[model samples]
Target: MGQQTVNEPPVVEGPATQEFAPEVEKLINTVAKFTVLVSQKLPDDVAARLKELAEEETAPMAKMIYSTMARNQDLAWQLKRPSCQDTGLVQLFVRAGTDFPYLDRVDAAMKEAVARATKWSPLRLNTVETFDEYNTGTNTGSRSPWIYWQTIPDSDSLELDVYLAGGGCSLPGQGKTLMPGEGYEAAVKFVLDVMTSYGINACPPLLVGVGIGSSIDAAAYMSKAALMRPVGSHSANPKAAELETELKDAIDRIGLGPQGLGGQHSVMGVNIENSARHPSVLSVAVNTGCWSHRRGTIRIASDLSYELLTHKGVEL
Candidate 1:
């Protein structure tokens, strides 16, 4: 009989067996590094708005404060350090496709990246057990790194948004349930009240996020969703978009301008996210972003290649 040659089976890459390439892994690490970097450097648009406010600000103290903020932002970027010592807690909003090769391991990779970042970038250890009051030091523990996941169908890539929520900015987060009859006007009033009182404290030229729906929790979650919006973006619905614009103008008139010292700009913009509510109840929630708004986004392909979305043209 002729000698039979044996052929090795073809290699297959599955979710369990696939590994991210060296460059891809490096990209993930780079994201963590950039997260720390951007947290220190306010966006150009934000900085420009602050400058305008400083020029137009009538309050001497507020003008001086705005000038100091602008200077501090410049220095923080030049020094490549965190603008705020708190650095806040890290939150990741991930939209992953079921077919993405690294979907299963993305969470692990993120946790690892965060830990590496803590050591390399020196991010503050903000994760403390509520009851125990013990800091994790590494910023990675049970739910210490907040992640929100959404699965998309028939997609081959994953999109990740990183948000750093500071204590002061998050402190003004408020939500309430109202009777359906209260309608949108009531919701608007609630937001106005919050901004008039706590908005100054949140560091004006704030990005206001409003959520409207049923249930206090749902409204609150929607409000946070609003914060994910781009500075100048508006709602899809015409009415909602109009409300956003109106609120923005009203806030600017508040003169809470940069760092709450008072200026021409009280808010950078306003965004609203709404959902269908129960017949009997309507809920509204609000959250604010400080002047030093820190957020970044990246999208990864099925092959583990990625793109940075938040800071335009940023590679890795």
Candidate 2:
């Protein structure tokens, strides 16, 4: 009081802003942990199917190899290690609500989660720049965590589907734009032809995803989307759903079976994705999934709370 000294106010820090819901943050971490766990564990259904195929396989050598594979998968799961040497590329399909709280930072957070998962799960460094050939040992780089986005109306949460797509399985994606006059029959025939020719190499009991639309690129994208449908799920459109069933039947009749050793189940399922197209053009695309069929999905609320769709009972 006597000196009347002037003192400046002290700077105070506020609490950190939470861009995402606590539930969402928890879910993301859970997914990251499960991704590694799933890579190591072959689900019971998959194991049983493989066993049935091994027993039914006519090719003696193929059966023997398949038996060995089943044994290896069992060992890997028991040991908590990756089922296959190639952990594959991580791809995420995200359906987010417009009202999602952490909408802006969701993608960035996902990329960081992938990187962390790669280190914690010790995922294979699969991403490499096409021209530069730089391996991003962390399983992430520019666009390394591939994401497909959709805005869900009137919802408060987000849904995420993750796929660990192996190079062998993804190699079969193909599309062609045909003259409209070529007709839907022609498209169906083309799909069959592709399967008959290369389906064996793709590792059957395949999940067949077909896309039909205006342009080759659009169709190609739809085809990949079809792969996200659950096994035995059909398109919502009646005609499209019928096509899925028919195609599944036709493919199964091919007798390619599990591992292409030949059996009753050439494909486990088929799904079709379609779009309205220009009058003059008909585009068709096809993508295949191997028997391993490794994929996981999660849904989050606008408030950032989430649910894991693919692997039931899994919490984040």
Candidate 3:
């Protein structure tokens, strides 16, 4: 949440004053360890979705592929290793109250976590300079391992949505701004266009995120953010939920299946996140998340009590 926030909600500071300075360092170290744990383990929600999708698939080859995906996940857990060879990119979506004692340390905590995770989880060396093309090896660099933040007013907890943005899925991301006359129909058409044009390579069944807002960048950011949400959770708005259902159905009909092999369902789910739009412009963006769909959410309370929402019963 570097600075993609639209307009931050009002936050009232709590007891995180000068007396808590020592606690800040501890919190950073805690977050760093949590990052390593997240990197190597597949979240339960993703595993459940894969199981559900596998059951729905009727094609022999597709079913076999899903079985293999499940086996890979099993082996990763059994061996306590990364599920994929290309760990891809790390992106953390954070929600924290301004009053949290460790607020100042959040950014550093995240960076330190990424660096530590590279060696601990043994993550792939994904950060390279833009033009120079030299690997940083540690996955920490200028704007690398991006973190998105949203502040929750009157709260004293840090909630993190950690995601491994695999390169295969990110390759198909695209955004566009439709003119006033284009209407919502045009937005759906654009999503369909993206799926047909590029979804196969990303390794379906995909979790499709569709973002609609006032501008391309805004929508693009939301689209990526949407992926961080729980896989099957839809927007609260009825219209938005309907759009999500329609998009999921339509995209699944594309039959990209597991690893792009033809089958009954192409996508596991389609999630739409939207905000008020400028009357003259309807900006939309689409992001695909592959079957692995590695994302997890963890929350740490002011009292230091912790919970892993996506991975139940996890102490960290």
- Model 2 C-alpha RMSD vs. true structure (Å) is 11.4
Name the lDDT value of residue 249 in candidate 2: 86
> Which predicted model would earn the best TM-score?
3
Tell me the deviation in Å of residue 308 in model 3: 0.6
TM-score: model 3 vs. ground truth: 0.90
**lDDT values for all models:** 0.77, 0.77, 0.82
- Candidate 3 segments exceeding 4 Å error: 1-22
Q: Once superposed on the true structure, which residue ranges of model 1 sit more than 4 Å away at CA? A: 1-28, 43-61
Candidate 3 local lDDT, 44-66, one digit each (tens) = 87778889888877889999999
Model 1, residue 199: what's the lDDT?
Answer: 90
Better of 2 and 3 by lDDT: 3
Q: For model 1, how does the per-residue alpha-carbon lDDT over 202-257 read when each residue is reduced to its tens digit?
A: 76678899999888988888888788877788899999999999999888887776
TM-score for all models, in order of appearance: 0.86, 0.83, 0.90
Model 2 C-alpha lDDT per residue in residues 35-134, reported as the tens digit of each score? 7766766444455556776776676656766777778777876786777777889988888888777778777677767776787777888987665566
Q: In model 3, what lDDT does residue 165 have?
A: 86
Q: How much does candidate 2 score in TM-score?
A: 0.83
Which lDDT value does model 3 have at 217? 91
